[model samples]
Each structure stands twice: as structure tokens, then as C-alpha cells.
Target: MPETPQLQVQCDAMIGSLHINADFTTTHPWTVLFGPSGSGKSSLLRFIAGLWKPQESHVILGADNITTTPVYKRKIALVAQQPALFPHMTVRENIAFGTESNQAESIAQMFDLFALNALADAKPATLSGGERQRVAIARALASTPRLLLLDEVFTGMHRTQRDTLMQQVRSHCVAHNIAVLAVTHDLPEALEADEVLRIESGHISAQGSPHAVLSEECTAWIQGVTSLREKL
Candidate 1:
């Protein structure tokens, strides 16, 4: 199998109220961008996805400089918090929508991979939030993107459901050698990533193993939890 491309990003710009300055390359298959709300995690993902153009930017995937690449031609998929599936299309049809050539075998694999077999003929309006997100991810994977950007897509799902889906998605991405950069403020989600990029005030504060980068914050969170228990 061919080697997967490395994602290199160096963007410095004021996107609305936030001034984002980020320069990093992905070192793991699953990297999480962790930060508080309004910290510009989603903005960087948008920059990489070519959805938002910054004043200064240099985004390279593998050997290709895709800073100015069009959204459709970039081969990068961004699944936002909302599933945004087409109400008119069935679950299977939505999965096959963005693919240039939707092979039968590939489509079937996505259904099995995302546990969408039961919902194949169901329209988006009939699916639950979790089910819709699963279909959205399945659709993104069908497009065979070089990189996957997830902007808190699992936010509203129940913990058990979210955890199960995360495991499935991570395993699939690792097996296929597709790099994923997911944005999340949830500590548990960040802890599950192979690497974590901690953003603060629109700047990347640290990038390393999740434990090392988030240890201090995690400690404080734990202490607070313990104190609450003691008070109760």
C-alpha cells in the first residue's frame, strides 16, 4: 500500500473576532484539536478544508500545496456538528451522493462499517440524531478523502453511542491510513485521540500525547469532581 500523506498547516489570520495563528503537522492518524469554545479550533479545520480563506495560509497535504484548492477538489471532508443530510435522499443514497463513482462493494462496506444496514432505505427525516451522524460520516468516507475534519460531530450523542462510534471510526481510519483531525472540547473525546493539539485564544498552545498535553487541566477537573463528591 502507498504511504499516507502528512498534513502540514501554517495559518495566521484574524477570522472574525478571533486571531488564529497555527502551525503544525499531523503526527498521528487520529489527532484531536482541544480547546474551549471560541478558541478557533473549528476555524483551523475550515482553513484546512478550504471553506474559510485566511489572509496568510500554507496548507500542504503530502507533497501538494492545497492552500488555494477549491473545496470540492481538495479531497478533504469536513463533517460539522450538524449532519445536514439531504431530506429527499435515503440513507444509502446519501452515502453515495458525493462519490465520483459509487461502487456497489464500497457502498456496502460503508453500510456495514457504520452500522447503517437497518437504515438503508430510511430518509434523513426518519433517522435519529446519532443515526444521521453515522450516515454523514459514512458519506464522507465514501468520498475517499485524504483527510477527515470533524467539528464536534459527536456532541449530542449519548456517551455510550458516541464512544462506540468513535472506536469504529478510529479503527477504520487507521486501517485505511486516512488521517483525521477532529475538534472537540470534551475531555473524554480528546483523551481518546492519538495526539492532542491544545488551542488557547486562537493559538496552538501545545501539541503532544493527550496525557502530557492535557495533564494539568485533567488534574484540575478531577480535583473538582472529587471535591464535589466530598461535599455531597
Candidate 2:
């Protein structure tokens, strides 16, 4: 089989008094960055999104070097834990915000694929948690991004909602041939990914297929959570 295209990032950043060093290249269709809180997973995602500049770094997506590329120019869409929708804009306008005029119909079709048609006329403030997340993802897809960065996007979502959203995200990425880097502390969520990476002390300590990377100890720990409806 041919090698998968990857997003390569090498960098160091300061977090509080600690220095975070992340060096990893991921080719998995869905690469989950798993770690404890403050392990720099969020920072790493932010760096990839061009939201945080590293002290010395190089970010290469496929053959393009986007280290200094502006956030808007990188064609990388980010979905944070909290849906950052524009409160003033209707869902339709938010989804079509930066897309070209000719792509509006196509974008709307994409939204329909996500079952977001009815909510298109609703404002952000009126939508429920799941609805807002779906809209956020729809907006991101409208950008026709090369990569999608998800940072704890499953937070605040019910189990069914989370599962549904994850399925949609997976399908969307595969259908669009877009790479994904999902950051999460949830082990079960990480299991849904093609590859799981564990970060600790500013470095990637373990990484492999879910069955390979997730330790027995970690598995046991997650099983204790009443919220995890299914086993990894």
C-alpha cells in the first residue's frame, strides 16, 4: 500500500512556566491526540491552526509549508469544544460566511447532508448543544479545508449526540478526503480514531492503533465512567 499523506509539525512552546515540545507526523485518516489536561494537546492543535505561533517550528501539510501561513490562508478549519458560532448571524449565513458565491448551493447541500436544513434559519443562541456543533461543523466544511482540527468537540454533548457527531465527522472527512487531527482526553473517543497518540510531559509517549496504544490501565479507567456507553 502507498504511504498516507501527513501533517508534519515540529515545535516548542511555553505553557505557563513549562515548555511544551511536540514532534509528530500523522498519516492516519483520523489521528486522535490523547492526553491529560495541560498536556499541550490543545496548544498543539492551536499551533497547527495558526492560532498559536511556536518559538521555532515548521508545519508542513502534504508538500506545502504553512509555518508562517495566516490562519485564513492555511485552509485549516478548527472546531473547538465550545461552538464558536457568530451570535449575530443566522445559521445559513454562518455556514456560508467565507465560502464563494458559486459554492453556496454546494455548501447548502453539504449542510443538508448533516441534517442542518431546519436549523439554517435559527440563530446560534437558540440552538441546542448538538445543533450548534452540527452547524459549526457545517460551517467548517463550507470552507473546503485541507484539514480539520477538532479540540474536545464532544464535550457538553450527550452520549448519543457525541456518537452521532463522531460518525458524521468521520464520514465527512472520508468523503471529502480531508485529514483530521482530533484532540481529546476521552479514551473511548480516541478509540473511534484510526490511530491514537498519547501525549505526556510535552511529548508523545505512545502512539499506534487504538488496540495497540491504549494501555490496559487506561482501558480500565475509562470503563469506570458511567458516561462511556460502549467499550473501546
Task: Report the Cα lDDT for residue 33, model 2.
Answer: 93
Predicted structure with the largest TM-score when compared to the true one: 1
Error in Å for residue 201 of model 1: 1.3
Off by over 4 Å in 1: none
Instruction: Summarize candidate 2's per-residue lDDT along 88-151 as a digit string, tens digits.
Output: 9999999998888889776877677789887778999999888888888888888888899998
**What lDDT does each candidate get?**
0.90, 0.84
Report how far residue 172 has shifted in candidate 2, in Å: 1.5
Deviation in angstroms for 218 in model 2? 4.7
Tens digits of per-residue lDDT for model 1 on 1-232? 6566789999999988888989999888889999999999988998999988876789999889998889999989899999989999999899999787747776788999998999999999998889999999999988888899999998978899999999888888877778899999999889999999999998999999999999997999999999999999
Residue-pair clashes per prediction, in order, are 0, 0
TM-score of each: 0.96, 0.91
> What lDDT is obtained when candidate 2 is compared to the true structure?
0.84
